[model samples]
Target: MNFVHNITAIFIFAPFLAFIILLFLSRKKLKRGAIGFSADITTFLLFLSVPVSVEALWGVNISFAVSVTAILMAMILLVLEWKKTKEIEILKYVRKTWRLYFLLLAAGYVIIWLTGLALTVISF
Candidate 1:
């Protein structure tokens, strides 16, 4: 249990490592390995962002903040899709939502890392 907990903590702290590992591990098994593991990588990044934000003094319980943001974006995208196409396609919308959510979380994580570095350097 402790080993699993520690491994989880390490992955959350260094998420790129997890992504790299996944890419390599999946490459042989998956035809489009890197793309195939995107959702999994996004999840690792989302979890990473929550802790990074908290440590950077950006927000508390940031997973809730991001989850709401992702859902809101998904709803807005779905509405736009409905308006443009005159119908809602669940599977397509879900893929778009996943990509959107991944981009959002990745950007947030980078911002948090920069802010954390700045905080450390300036003692603020």
Candidate 2:
């Protein structure tokens, strides 16, 4: 049981571990990009899932705020990158690869959150 718990903890912390590893191994820009992207997706989900109770996890609100800010900053960087790249086809490819996942994840989170909210409201 202890071993199982330890494994689960490691699994849960793997992303953070990976971020640390990337920080040490990758260029500063690459590490920032990866971390910023992950933060955006995480915050988007948190914002979508906000509930009206103190019983819920406390960190969600903080994470939601940080994520939203990170996403906005990332968007600014993305625009700058696009302008600097100067190649239309390459810019399109970069946009699709880098942003598509965040867009889809945000959409999915919104859909699930809306559905859940509707169900709760209807039930009440």
Candidate 3:
């Protein structure tokens, strides 16, 4: 049990490992081999960041913050798509949503890491 927990912790903290693993799986099996896999990786990284934010004293309701951001992004995209084509294609909407999520999460991950690092250093 402890071993499993340690492994999970490693993945949570070092998400590059997850990205590499995803790259391999996508190339070897899925054969898509594009940047599509990054969306999943960043999503995991962002959601996992809630705990890190709490530890860094920057978040009391980090989960809610993340959720609301994602919802707002989707709504904005949905509105723009509707205006452009007078329709919302579900597949395209879904794809754009996740890709946008990937960018947002990646940015948030960097900011959160920097904030946490700064706070920790200042405390010491």
**Top lDDT: which candidate number?**
3
Per-residue lDDT over 1-124 for candidate 3, one digit per residue giving the tens place of the 0 to 100 score: 9999987887777665677777776776667743577556656775776556565566466777778878998999899999999978999888889888877776767777787788789999
Worst 10 residues of 3 by lDDT: 50-59
- A best-first ranking of the candidates according to their lDDT comes to 3, 1, 2
Number of backbone collisions per candidate? 0, 0, 0
- Provide the TM-score for each candidate, comma-separated: 0.82, 0.30, 0.78
Q: List the lowest-lDDT window of 10 residues for candidate 2.
A: 50-59
Question: On a 0 to 100 scale, what is the lDDT of residue 81 in model 3?
Answer: 93
Candidates in order have lDDT scores of: 0.72, 0.50, 0.74
Alpha carbon lDDT at 12, candidate 1:
76
Residue 107 in model 2: shift from native, Å? Answer: 1.7
Distance (Å) between predicted and true CA of 73, model 3?
A: 1.3
Candidate 1 per-residue lDDT, tens place, 1-124, comes to: 9999998877777666777788877787785856648455656566555556675475566666666776788789988999999977898778777777666666767787787888899995
Stretches > 4 Å off in candidate 1: 44-48, 55-59
Stretches of candidate 3 exceeding 4 Å from the true structure:
31-34, 54-59, 122-124
